[model samples]
Target: MTAIPSAELHTPDELLANASAMYASGDPKLFRGAILESITALEAFVQRTVFRSLEGRLDPLLVKWLEEKTRMDFDSRLSVLTQVATGLPINKSSELWDGYKKAKEIRNKVVHSGRKVTAMDVELVMASVRDWLSYLGTTVELEAVLLTLKRWVEQSPKPPIENEAQAIQLVAQYFHQSAAARITIEAEINTGGRRHRADMILDFGPRKVLVETKFPRLANNVRNVIRDAVEQADAKRQAANIGQACVIAFLRKRPEGVSDVVERHKGGGILSIAIETH
Candidate 1:
């Protein structure tokens, strides 16, 4: 896990962070914080991606007019941003307009009519904004790191890796200097059996992620490695009092039913990402 520094958090990230904090407090009224923040996050994403990209495309006078005369209201901004993004080659079209419309409508009701939004309202808004934000190149820091890792794995050589150590090294090559500083290799912890060694441990201040690497050639071999890695990750996580962990399986062939396993463990704070080399 890569820790995102507070300084590097974009507007959407910061809003989501606040929303998460409020949600975790178990106060129902505070759910509004999540809704409001989600709206702001969507607006900020539009400014960052759509508005910023138009820096040189529009006439200077027109740009200045927009800056000075535009309503800066949520709906107005969203409309302009969507229009511009849809027309620009640099921007990707989104399928999130329906969700965006719903979110904005709910925001209007809540703010204009003093309405109370349920947990579902907040969840819906967040889910909708997430896609738009992602398309606009805005995401939480950890998500950004994970995306980079996925891209690295996809771009890596197709030949199977030699061993666990080589696979670990390959993953490490993608880490930034700051991330590299927080990594611990072969970290030892007491787990009833003298010393239980974790292949890698990433310390992200509040979140610790245990990573296990494996190179599997056969179907049975993949299962065995996954079992061992999950056990190792669990032991390390329990010892460290951390809840997040993942197993990276560098595979010659993806085993049948492995995707189901990955989906099952997703909500349980464990991830199984199979990186195919063949």
Candidate 2:
């Protein structure tokens, strides 16, 4: 998947970029992925707005319940978000509401029944997604919510890593907290002939970064390890439609000859960084 540089994009734009890429891919799974991201963008937006509106006064248990409820299946979640946000009942009279409902049906068809989705279906969903985004943006409170998220990203802490698992955890947490990138831990990606579990994935709209954390053993072949890491990163990138990869080697002790920060491997296919755990 081709991606525009996302170094300057806000969270929502990143999500939209992913949606656009998926819609353009001409693959059913890609289309489905696009639809899911589109909906997820709205869900996150709405949830943040709702939470902001409540002003940290909602009961802890109630807040948790609301969060879970907001995460219900697409249709239910959308309906709840619309109703809570607008205070207007979603009836047949509202074209935007109806359009979202239709989009939900299309998503279900592709996801549930293994039905082939058409380009038109993707177009319709995109339209609905845009409509929802626009609607949310028009409101002052929701717009403030969006700005808050962007600011929070600007103020986020750098990820701390001391071990292999912590490296993956901290990297994932860093992207998500700092840039509104969606983070997935231990996600399995198909590597052509087989599947491997990626330590983490940082999804930023059209572009994704696959991350791997390795704590190599004392007797492991260093050359072979580096070669395998580069190849694995490349394979996972292709499988996940990701454009970039980061492989972190948490060694028990710093190797004598290796560079601490070798930025890219195989001509930028991977970003290989090594850290000493001593």
Candidate 3:
């Protein structure tokens, strides 16, 4: 038989250009794995460039760029970047960082060990990577990725929690009953001069307690609500003959490290109760 010559593959840069073209043409999945591989390659390139430029003396320009990009003080940028290299999102970024990390692990497994990559896996990794890229203003092939991610999310086996408002109401009821001695329960206090309903209030005979009930998932939002409630409570207390006043957050579940937070602000008469439900 006559010998046939096999064509040589393109260079990394050429492959990257081809991938970019495919992405631009709306064929994102055509070279999804290759694009991710390119990102890995680019990361290595950035690291090598940094190391080569920094030989012994650090470049002030590079230092300034790093500081500006991260919005961090000079001393913390290097440490923060080291953590970021391990796939921590920049700026303590998103609640989905854990999900992104899990997706990245799957990607690494597939790429390095030739493991089977499922559609779901690819979808998750693409979504997270695209989000991170968009946040950083980096170019990403999003259309196809988003489509795949949507499908994956739609096909996800978990059932969505329902009646979040009802759940919060239940938690508020629990807290009200539990603290009946020191706290007086009042529902739907119209405040904010707009008939805004306060979920529950704990009435201290002399000093009033404003309780804003929220789901455990909205723990961060509770902080601002608590702050506003504190100010409002103080205003109400001042307008009356109350001795001390504060706001308490009654959550469906305790947030991590929240007990310490409660203790820290307990001196200020503010309380946060993380309600445990059966």
Residue pairs that clash (backbone atoms under 3 angstroms), model 3: none
* Candidate 1 global lDDT: 0.60
lDDT per residue for candidate 1 within 156-249, as digits (tens), equals 5545466777888766554424432267887777877677777777765435667777887677677777877777787777887766677778
Instruction: Say which candidate scores most in TM-score.
Output: 1
Native-to-model Cα distance after best TM-score fit, residue 55 in candidate 2, in Å = 4.1
Show where candidate 3 strays beyond 4 Å: 1-164, 175-196, 202-208, 216-229, 232-261, 264-267, 275-278
Q: Count clashing residue pairs per candidate.
A: 0, 1, 0
Off by over 4 Å in 2: 1-14, 25-29, 55-57, 73-77, 81-92, 140-278
Worst 10 residues of 1 by lDDT: 1-10
> Considering TM-score, which of the candidate structures 1 and 2 is the better prediction for this target?
1
Better of 2 and 3 by TM-score: 2
Candidate 2 overall Cα lDDT vs. reference?
Answer: 0.61
Tens digit of per-residue lDDT, candidate 3, span 156-263:
443332444664444344344332224443444434453444444544332334444434457656556556666665554444434333333445444565542221
So what's the TM-score on candidate 1?
A: 0.49
